[model samples]
Target: MPAISDAKILIIATDGFEQDELFGPRERLLAAGAQVVLASPGGDPIQGMVQDQKGDTITPDILLDAVDIEEYDALVIPGGVANPDTLRTIDAAIEIVRGFDDAGKPIAAICHGPWLLVEADIVEDRTVTSWPSVRTDLENAGAIVVDRSVVVDDNLITSRKPDDVPDFTDALIRLVEEAEVDA
Candidate 1:
């Protein structure tokens, strides 16, 4: 597992994020000693949906347009039907993902979260997994989409659904740790 101590991680999401997808991985990452910073379209707290129905909100640490990707070691995108749907339409959100990719930083996206990957135009020729609904989007974007608990291709890690959060978080930790070693 990665030594997350002092490692900074950026989580991108917005209103309508799946509660589990956002909180589950965030808590695990924090417990592992990483500094998790939440980013959204604006600085306001983003709402989360439980199983697509229940609602709650989480305050973001930074705004998408204001964030400096160079300050973080990794990025995570959480999925909710409304979350990624809204995010994909935001230019700033897409740019943040692209910035992380250009920086060669580790990234993890779970469930419907992979939608941003397609929007950022980073899925080409890459292997990934995501919630069933977005598999076609990934495929159409020229990615080799798979059905799995977790798939790690280079610095990017992805998982199929919320049920795969454990595997997703573990892979993210390993990737960050490995990046630290390589750096």
Candidate 2:
């Protein structure tokens, strides 16, 4: 693992986020000593979905409208069918993605999470991977989408699905650590 002490990681999600996709990586990042902040479309608690069913709910630390991309070192998008679908429609969420991209900061999206990247128009010509269902969307956005446990291209990292969380989290941690070093 990398030393992420004092690192600030921002996670963007909304209702319908995959339970594991959000919590698994959140826990790992916290354990690695990174400060994790959850941001959502609204300020209320966001419900999570497990295998497409209702699961636990978590209160967000901030609202998408309030996040300043420069305040955090990295961004994480946890996916579920409903999560990204809702996120893509939110201008604040899309702007956040754009801000991260323009700043050259690390942005990690898992499963259907890459939908936000497509919405922000940042995946064009980037190599990425996401849930099987969203492969076409990614490709249509001009991204070279692949099927893999995790794909790290430049400062963007992506994964196929929940089963790939371990590898995805590892890649994210390393990316953050490397960014910290570069800074």
Looking at model 2, the pairs that clash are none
The 10 consecutive residues of candidate 2 with the worst lDDT sum are 1-10
18 Cα displacement, candidate 2 (Å): 0.2
Q: Which prediction has the highest lDDT against the true structure?
A: 2
Instruction: Point out where model 2 deviates above 4 Å.
Output: none
Clashing pairs in 1: none
Question: Against the correct fold, how does model 2 do in TM-score?
Answer: 0.97
Tens-digit per-residue lDDT, 86-142, candidate 2: 999999999999999898899999999999999999999999999989999999999
Q: What are the per-residue Cα lDDT tens digits for candidate 1 across 84-162?
A: 9999999989988899899889889998999999999999999999999899999999999888899999988999888
Model 1 reaches what TM-score against the true structure? Answer: 0.96
After TM-score superposition, the amount by which residue 160's alpha carbon in candidate 2 deviates from its true location, in angstroms, is 0.8
- The models' CA-based lDDT, in order, is 0.91, 0.92
